[model samples]
Target: MSRLIQDAYTLAKERYAGLGVDTDQALATLDQISLSLHCWQGDDVAGFENPDAELSGGIAATGNYSGKARNADELRRDLDLAYRLIPGTHRLNLHAIYAETGDQKIVRNELQPEHFASWIDWAKANHHGLDFNPTCFSHPLSASGFTLSSPDPAIRQFWIDHCIGCRQIGASFGRALDTPCVTNIWIPDGFKDTPADRAAPRRRLKESLDQILAVPIDRQYNLDAVESKLFGLGAESYTAGSHEFYLGYTASRNDVLLCLDAGHFHPTEMISDKISAALLFVPAVVLHISRPVRWDSDHVVTLTDEVQAILHEIIAGGNLDRVHIGLDFFDASINRIAAWVIGARNVMRAALLALLEPTDRLRSFETAGDYTARLAFQEELKGMPWAAVWDQFCVQQEVPIGIRFLDEVKQYETRELSKRA
Candidate 1:
């Protein structure tokens, strides 16, 4: 056996010993281990997968919204669809609103008490099996230009009111769903150019976060503060920037946690070690998994071999369980469903690789009391190409290749086009 395979065998033996399993059971367990079962959904997948398709497309296509009904169904069908796509065992990150203007901004006009209530009902019915995270508001109003720093209080209050309104909506959703509605706060609130005032904008964000947490809600919600490096307000200028700034800001606040985006960290710094360390402080409630190419961060769920190794090492060192995995992709060109399916596949492979580490090896590294273990682990992973591992595992499990999945999506698109014709 190769070193990696030997390591896997050793870990299996240890697990079997803990379970008091005989050699026969250990071998059987090893044989049954597959790589397609370890992934979870990120909210961005819904938006990225189908820009035109409402959240309902990812959830279910069976509901309707008539003109200004007081009781709107925010996500009943979508929630059902989300439930179907992800088994109850996995976490589902639901986007509250797609970041858009005019007709696309569904939350501004339609997400009323009745719609909120329907979401709550759907969540409560399905909570026993599935874990749900209702990411807080994301729309033009929620962005930097529209928040507390705005010259007009009405505009700022509109943002605040939206937060307050969403809290009420979230409370209903959580009550009906029986799961905590995670407050995902990602503000494109920084200056596009050199800020006329740097500290002021950050202070505004802090105030907003503090105010939101103070509101009375039924269940405990985590404020997942997303860190990005891109300086500025508009989507075009906002590049994924430094996470340390966001992490430092939220760490002091109660009920607040960091929502680490893998690609976001790639631009500012090498994230593996920094991320490992961050987990030591704040609880990471959610993860945005993607790869960064050049300066632009592509939401391709494709993992480089080095990244897979680092992620595995981080998990083996004990950060995996703290956060829910989100298969985040935001590419406009790719088919959204294909992105979700393919991204989920890559995430599963990453998880299996992480889980395959031997407990003793992990413990020994932890006991060493030095940070060098991260480096050593990276060295161990140096020779192993994750692409090869992914390919081999796909073949072994009889799962479709990424290219095949993409082609399937293309065919679906073609059929849809024909129907339109």
Candidate 2:
């Protein structure tokens, strides 16, 4: 480690000590939190099977960034590069569409664990835990923006079968790695124009989900989750699987999780408040951390106020262990590797910042009705030398500090990513 970084950390540690915060404990807690890196970012949500397929269901990658992975090998290579730049071990979240079928045209319903055998092998080799998602978008069946909620029984059955298969695959992944794989199901079932029969579609969706969950897999290997969206590309008027619907569904069930995407709610509604509320009823919670500009744009996550607030609530609520953290954003405008590094590092940074706070002191002040002292201490804590501690963490992790990681990314682009053409 550099002498300057070491000296800065010592001073910062002393400052935090005065606030009744233990720097070492904070760092240890930060190290234990693993943010699952989304695999779709490297390829702009364009999976390996079909290159010509266009993104649908409000899913879009804006930039025509160069160096996108053409195949699974290339994608894994880029992910390894990004993973190296990131500190600590993490999990990789994958969609079912990313499966390698080779010459076979295996339908989603017919998908088997063998299709993801390569991913399991790769994850095992790299010490990375894996998470799974059922891709209900960017497919022909979903072009209508309805999958599980379709009025046609055949169409609904097809999607139900696909989700059932995805759950088994998730269980296989968890069993292979000995860690529970969160199998999340997100569908683009909604209407661009307001529907007169919203009730019908929601009823069908409930039936479809009931059938999907009929086949129970062991929870030891896999946990089921349903994701909700406010609105999207074609489905702007109404989303069948709205937050209320999923919240109610999760509350009724014991095995499922309610996924709260930051970008999936109204602009004014912050998910930081919802975390505690949802966990109160549901068995647990799953988070898809992303930044939304005006809507559900799925922009790359930054260490914004909302992000910090979300982490703070999770820690303060004492539900960190019950909540699963995953990143869900795709930005094709910049270096994909850099996007991963920046987002993952920001999450870690936010966790560290939250950890460094004297939560007990603030809570005690609030309980004692000292609002003035509580507000002052909270505002003043922001000025602490948190950055120095973060930099020191980078030094300890043996990863690049600050802007240095970007230099390494540029080098990789020249020697590796540029040659994709």
Candidate 3:
């Protein structure tokens, strides 16, 4: 067991013993925490803008590509900045330009496919971990932002070709880096205005995926199907208006896994328990960690009591092993640097708390529950208030603000270094 898990178990035992609970529940809970930590691994999609600069109104309002470089030299500078800004302990899910450019619908669309070779070379040379989402092209192809049942075969074919190319590039990159490339395939491929079109798109999407999976690739990849809210389409218009359609489809495919985005579940008002249960069957390879603010999802992590309780239950349920906890932030109206910091802190706090929870007791609880007994049972979480625990964990983790600043400084330094070199 990791030292973190061991320490958490000790703390839980000491605390629960004082509560007069001696049924071994506390020890079991601690063991669960240990198991979770043992299986812990995470990564996030890249291109997280800095929150401070974004909020300060530094970025362009048009949402054009002006901040980062498009060439090899520019990429090197950015990679160096990422290392300096993000702490060494934190692993990034570097978004391939394919996904970013596809999402932004840049006029040239030249950053991704055209530049894929160089990006892979850069990652291998620099030793940066990669997290790629190959199907971001579907976002624009969908007329309603998620309807895969479009009659336009031309548009569909375009996306299909793009996905195929992306997979080929990803496979090569993974082999070069000797790292498992996480292929997160999320589509805004649902219906927008009609419920009738929902089933067809989902079916077609599965067909499309089937074709891609048939392609020969050597890299060990996971098809992370991200479930998100129904946009452009009415809530009730889609398949039961939930993400289960996508999940069920991906689960049927070989070597494909689900990428659970915490914010995506917000629209359905599904709590952590529902998420835990839904994903228990399919291993979760990556997690997009963020807080949800009312209707606007993916807010900064605020260490709320509700959030802690939800996360604790999920960790106790045994899905943390396939986790790649990555930062996902988009604040159209705030400083980009501040946004990055907030997103990073959110991920850090959640991870630390997850590491602190007891594991043994949780497993026992899972087994101890008779259908009736378990239904009536309530979990006894022993610790300081969640906020206090969060604070303590942050202190323990020792994540410094300087780490966030490092990326910016590194960007400048890299630029100068390249200029001189």
Question: What C-alpha lDDT values do all the predictions have?
Answer: 0.46, 0.92, 0.46
Go through the candidates in order and give the C-alpha RMSD of each one to the true structure.
8.6, 0.9, 8.5
lDDT per residue as tens, model 1, 39-153: 1222223342134434321121121212111112322332233233321234444444422233343544334545334334444565431223333224444444435445465
TM-score preference between candidates 1 and 3, better one: 1
Residues 205-257, candidate 3, lDDT per residue (tens digit)? 66666765677765464233444443422332443224676567656654566
The top-ranked prediction according to lDDT is: 2
Residue 279, candidate 2: C-alpha displacement in angstroms: 0.7
Residue pairs clashing, model 2? 58-233
Per TM-score, what order, best first? 2, 1, 3
lDDT of 2 by residue, 182-291 (tens): 99999999998979998999999999999889897999999999999998888889999999999999999999999999999999999998999899899999999999
Error of 2 at 135 (Å): 0.9
Which ranges of candidate 1 are over 4 A from the true structure?
A: 1-88, 98-110, 116-146, 218-228, 232-245, 266-268, 306-310, 362-421
Give the C-alpha lDDT of model 1: 0.46
* TM-score per model over all chains: 0.65, 0.99, 0.64
